[model samples]
Target: MKAFVIERYGKQEPLHLAEVPEPKLGEQDVLVRIHAASINPLDLKIRSGALKRILPLRLPLVLGNDLAGVVTQVGTKVQRFKPGDEVYARTDTRRIGTFAEFIAVAESNVALKPPSLSMAEAASIPLVGLTAWQALVEKGNLRKGQKVFIHAGSGGVGTLAIQLAKHLGASVATTTSSANVALVKSLGADIVIDYKKDDFAKTLRDYDLVLHSLGSEELEKSVGILKPGGQLITISGPADPEFAKNNGMPKLVQMIVGLLSRKIRKKAGKQGVGYSFLFMRGSGEQLSTLGELIHSGAIRPTVDRVFPFEETNEALAYVEGGRTRGKAVIQVVALANQA
Candidate 1:
């Protein structure tokens, strides 16, 4: 299989195209012939070694997380999928290597691709879609008619989060710059705050939930805007003890997070609100549910750009710059054209 791999962590210059041996499938895994793969901020962080402590990596690592592909083979225990089945998934972070001609993903982390989308579109949906779904629906338990705020409404996760929140019947508010206000609004954000000009914390108030993607400073201020006992979920850092326990994090990581939470927790406490951090895990069941939503037009994939397989570096550069309005995808194989 052909793959783009990094021979070393830290330097972007080390990323190079190379031929590698295909992954040996485990009893619980399936081999996927990759059609498209999406770039994510998490990939950049991993490539730069920013997550070394939390997610250790070996050298010459292939870097990608979300993919849409066709099943070429399935392990003995994989009864849900078979050869020729089209699937999409947010692959496990520990084994992610989707920037390739193929991937071997655990069956538990694979889902049937939404029938309504192309491979590139399907590839863009998984990671960010799962993140939004887990944050708002699973963890936050956002209710219909309730107000929910999503930060970075024009970004990958924000775009999907806005649509999902609306589909669930929640009145959604989102933050974006002035240029993207119209885009977010069109996607179903009832209110759009221009983060560059206006302070969202001061302008928006009495929200039932705040899906925050920014840093700790913005997260702290978000509590003031929440209605009493409302929840504030951040994807950035400082994990909440209660959510950590519920999510079944390792005891050592949980303990370290607990000590850190005292600082942020005290702040949320002062405002009479709940605070938690979100570290999304892959789930095939959740992916299938999201796929159904996509197929039904309840939620749609919003892609800002698509690059050819050879232009993978350029695609990564675009996503790393943080200027993209929505998801960026690399069409790895153009499976439709091959047929």
Candidate 2:
């Protein structure tokens, strides 16, 4: 199958399209014919080798994280899904290759796509949706009537998070540019802070949870806004020692992470708040819950644009530009008139 792959890691390097052998299907895997895939900031980070120490990928790697596809075959031990089942997934981190025409995903990490969404829409949900689910529900334990702050409210994760927080009955606040204030509000953000015009940290206070996805400065500010005993979960970060230990990094790496996050962790402790880093993992169970939410209209996929398969690199560039309102998808399967 023809797929786009990075021969080496470099920020300016382009992905080369090449014919490659099919992925080997495991006993617990399902072979999927990918219809659409989504671009993520993690893809850019991986391609640039920014995460080399933490997430070492084999050279000439295929680059994509989320996909919506149809099952073409099922492994011997796979029982939850069968051939012809429509599904979507954030492929397990170690087995990522959703940029291709097909992928063999572990059955435990795959979920049926919501019938209410198109393939492109479904593709946009898994990664960002799962990120929100893990951050808010699993880690934050955000409850009804509580206040939560989500940064970058117009971005991929932020858009879905706002909806999910609202679905969980939390009063949501978010930071976005003036142009996107309306967009975030439409997604159920009760308070939209225009970051370009105002300082969110100075204006918002006593939040039960702060989902921090920005720089160190913003993260420090996020800690101040959280009430005592509140959680400050950061997706972009100086990975803390807890995350390092949980992921089983080398002792040296764990020490490095601890030192990097020492300042923020100490500040959080002084203020009686908790701080931790989150690197979301794939989970079929979580995706199933998200699918129900999408199907019920409690949440909706926000697709900013869809590029043709051949323009996959362009899609990545667009996402990296950081002007997108929501997620960007690549239509992998050619339409009737396309070459």
Candidate 3:
């Protein structure tokens, strides 16, 4: 099967389409014939070797994370899914490669695609949806009448997190450019700051939680905005020690990770704010819950573009340009064609 792979890791090295051996199916996995795959900033990080130290992998690695497809085969141990079931997933990070024509995902990480969404649309949900779910509901424990801030409100995760925060009954505040203030508002953001003109730290204060997806500068600013006993969960991070420990990192590496987040954690601690890093893991059950929200129209995908599978490289480049209004997905096979 033809798949996009990186022979070497570097910013200059581009993913090349090559004939790779088909994926091996495990007894607890389902073989999905991918109809669409979504591109994320995580793909860029891995392709450029930015995350190589934390997530070391062999070369000739395929690049992709979110996929929506049809199950062509099911392992003997798989009970919930079978051939012909339309499904979608953010495959486990350790085995990510949804950019290919087929991928065998563990049955526990796969969920039925929301019936109301097209494959391209559903492909945009998994990673971002899971990120938002874990940040707002599970980790943040956001409650009604509380305030929460989500950074980068127009990007892939930001678009979803804003809606999830709203759905959880919290008053949502988000930062976006002038072009997207209206967009975020439509997603239920109670306060939308034009990041280019105003500072979010000054605009929002005493928040119950903050879902952050930016760098050190934004991290510092986000931590200050939270009130006493508030929590800040960052997906883009200088991996904290707790995250390293939870992932079973070497003690030396964990020590280094702790040193990296020391200053910020100390700052948060002084203000009675809690800080932790969140690296979202795939879960079939969480996807199932999010699927209901998507299906019921409580949350909707904001897909900026649908590139053909052949244009996966272009799609990645577009996402790297940092001007997307929402997510982008590569359509590998068009299912139903709008019925």
lDDT of each: 0.89, 0.93, 0.91
lDDT of 3 at 104: 93
* Candidate 2 residue pairs in backbone clash: none
- Predicted candidate 2 versus true structure: per-residue lDDT over 214-324, tens digit per residue: 898999989899899999999997899988898889999999989989999999999999998999999999999999899789999999999999999999999999999
Q: lDDT of model 2 at residue 311?
A: 96
Candidate 1 residues 47-135, lDDT tens each?
Answer: 98877756777878999999998999999999999999999998887898999999999999999999889999999999999999999
Better of 1 and 3 by lDDT: 3
How far residue 157's Cα lies from its native spot in candidate 1, in Å, is: 0.5
Error of 3 at 261 (Å): 0.8
TM-score of 2: 0.98
Q: Per-prediction TM-score, please? A: 0.94, 0.98, 0.98
Flag regions of model 3 displaced more than 4 Å: 334-339
Better of 1 and 3 by TM-score: 3
- The better-scoring model by lDDT among 2 and 3 is 2
Task: Give the top-scoring candidate (lDDT).
Answer: 2
